[model samples]
Target: MVKINILYASTEGNTTSFVTKLTDIAAENGDIVVARCIGEETDYANETAPFVAIVPTYLTGGTGTGPEVTEIFTNALGDYIAFGRNRQYLKGVIGSGNRNFNVQFNLTATRYAQRFNVPMLFAYELRGSKFDAEKAYHIIKPLFGE
Candidate 1:
């Protein structure tokens, strides 16, 4: 089975719940899934599995971002990339945001994907729906050669 590492950051628990469902789905698909919340753990550079990040957008006007979450990932992965470590691991991202934010919606995922040169697999509004979880699974499964 392929191993998948998920790093998540949640402000009000919505992103956490959404990631939990996605983790269950990934597990059901026979992939080994390991998850860590940003503040709870610091090091992501040692992860040997393909990486996935689930984060929520905290939009400050038009500048959409997840400051702490992004910083954690950036610090770890930036060093890894600079040192040419874990270069073969595939990376994926998912973002949660309020639709009322308009153009800023899901911008966190977008920015992260660009930074890492990975794909933004899915972007969900608020807590996300059942359909969004399923779609995320489908997108992620194939990356594991499932």
Candidate 2:
């Protein structure tokens, strides 16, 4: 069976909802998805399989139109991946955001991919529509190779 590992962080339930749909879709299609959501406590796993990370954008300072997209709102995912062991297993990144945020949209995912030297694989707006979930599922499925 095709298998994938999904590591993600969500605030305000949007990213969690998206990952849940992605996981459910994988199961429906007879694929395997081992998914984990970061929480208030730092959780690290010795991930043996390749994994993709998903994060939503939360930037501090300035409106989208301004030049001051300064900081990421949370460091939880950063710390989770910073476990040193975890970074090697990361395969790619997906992100969620409000398009209205402009340059800051999906900023966390983009930065994570860059920092970890992985591909910026996919992105969806906010919680993502069912169509977006299906699209993400297809994109991820191919990565596992039948």
Candidate 3:
């Protein structure tokens, strides 16, 4: 069976909700998914399985044109990957964001994918849509030769 680890953090729970959907799809497809929620107080571990990261775009303005765009909100998520050997095991990233944010939508996941030299596997708005989880599974399953 295909196995994937997911590392994520949620602020308003949108990121958590999206990751949950992915996990549900993986289960229905007979794949193994290990979902880990990382927080500032969580201990770090060197990942042994290929993993995906989920991050949400948090902007100061609803229009995303404000000057308050900052990385401070998801510092814990970034720190989790920055820990020993975690970066090496990252397979890809799936981003959730407000599309109303214009070019800033899903920017966090895009940045992580680029930094880690991995694909930005999937993206969707808050908590994803009815079919987004399934679509994401199809995209990622082939990467593991499933």
Misplaced by over 4 Å in model 2 are 64-73
lDDT of 3: 0.80
lDDT of 2 by residue, 43-102 (tens): 565767778888888887777624476546457787788786989988788998999877
Name the regions of candidate 1 deviating beyond 4 angstroms.
28-30, 40-45, 61-90
Worst 10 residues of 3 by lDDT: 59-68
Per-residue lDDT of model 3, residues 1-146, tens digit only: 88877888788888778777888888888897788888888887777777778888765544443455565477788888988888988888888888877788888788778777899989999888759988887887776656
Where is model 3 more than 4 Å wrong at Cα?
Answer: 60-68
Cα lDDT over the full model 2: 0.82
Task: Provide TM-scores for the models.
Answer: 0.75, 0.88, 0.87
Q: After superposition, how far is residue 89 of candidate 1 from its true place, in Å?
A: 2.9
lDDT scores in order: 0.69, 0.82, 0.80
- How many residue pairs of model 1 clash at the backbone? 0
The predictions' CA RMSDs to the true structure, in order, are 4.3, 2.2, 2.4
Query: Top TM-score: which candidate number?
Result: 2
Can you write out model 1's per-residue Cα lDDT over 1-146, one digit (the tens) per residue?
76667777776889878877887777787776677776434454545667677778764433434453334223443344333455346477788888887767877778767877888888999988877988887877677665
TM-score for model 2?
0.88
